[model samples]
Target chain A: DVKVTQSSRYLVKRTGEKVFLECVQDMDHENMFWYRQDPGLGLRLIYFSYDVKMKEKGDIPEGYSVSREKKERFSLILESASTNQTSMYLCASSGRGLLDTEAFFGQGTRLTVV
Target chain B: TQLLEQSPQFLSIQEGENLTVYCNSSSVFSSLQWYRQEPGEGPVLLVTVVTGGEVKKLKRLTFQFGDARKDSSLHITAAQPGDTGLYLCAGHSSGTYKYIFGTGTRLKVLA
Candidate 1:
């Protein structure tokens, strides 16, 4: 079975603090994504990486940035956390295919900005 | 713009009942996917409908993609307590690698 691991399951940070969310996939997938899931909004993509060291901004990438140092790992960075940035963050990985392939997801990290 | 919209934000029903969730869109998609998410866990892939007017079944669950490829539906023949979760529909954005997910439907099946 393919596995996507998230660094933290729960986190609490003060306002204006920097935060890091890490995701690692063992499937050697070529695509990795970061999304924030809210109650009514579902999952909104924050960022996605198609290759190592290459990243692209998604719809809601204003307060977040991403880094993909290796093919197996992708990281989401919050430059400055705010109260409104608190949400359940999800990490997913997929192969280099069109829309037909399914994306494997990691257990989400619920972040709370105090 | 919300590319996809799911109807009935919340549903609570007794076990053995039947239900249907709809996912509609104005834009055409190469494929549409359905996922079920449990509390404290990531969303799990339930089914994917690619061809227009396609119908697929997984046991008691039935999925159909509209002929125009702009809509989809999921039907549960008999709901169980284990079926309680958030159901989401996602589609690959046209000419892009991004996926647009629908606002989820939260379902609760009571025993």
Candidate 2:
């Protein structure tokens, strides 16, 4: 089975602190994505990487940035954490194709900013 | 921007009841997908409908895509407690790899 692993299940950070969320996929998928899930807004994409070292901004990418140094690993970075930035973060990976492919996701990381 | 809208933000019903969740969009899509997510875990793919007016079934769950490829629906027959979760619909536009997910429907099935 394909596996997507998140570095932290729960995290708490103070305002103005820098935070890092890590995601690793066991399968050699070429696409990785970062999204923030809220109660009523659903999952909003923050950033996505189609290949190593290549990243694209999603709808809600203002406070977030991404790094994809290796094919299996993708990282989400919060330049400066704020109270409003607290939310459940999800990581997903999918195969390289134009066709609609199913994405495999990791257990989400719930972040709380104080 | 492409958007998918889901109706019935929350639904509660007794076991053995039937229910339907609707996902509507104004823009055409290449494919649409349904997912169920449990607490503390990521959303799991249930079905993907590609062709217009297509219907797919997985056991008691039925998924249908509109003929214009702009809308979809998911119907559950004899829903059980195991079916309780957040249901999300996502649409993928033609020539784009990105998916726009709809606001989910939270279903609670009680015994």
Candidate 1 chain A: 10-residue stretch with minimal lDDT: A95-104
lDDT (Cα, 0-100) at B49 in candidate 2? 94
Query: What are the candidates' individual DockQ scores?
Result: 0.65, 0.67
True contacts kept of each: 0.58, 0.58
> For candidate 1, what's the RMSD?
1.4
Candidate 1 lDDT at B67 equals: 99
Please, what are the lDDT tens digits per residue for candidate 2 over residues A1-114?
889999999999999999999999998999899999988889999999999999999989998889999999999999999999999999999887665367778999999999
Question: What's candidate 2's i-RMS value?
Answer: 1.5
Scored by TM against the true chain B, the candidates give 0.96, 0.98
lDDT of 2: 0.93
lDDT of each: 0.91, 0.93
* Candidate 1 structure quality by residue, lDDT tens digits, B1-111: 548999888999999999999999998888888999999899989988889999999998999999999999999988999999999998874446677788889999999
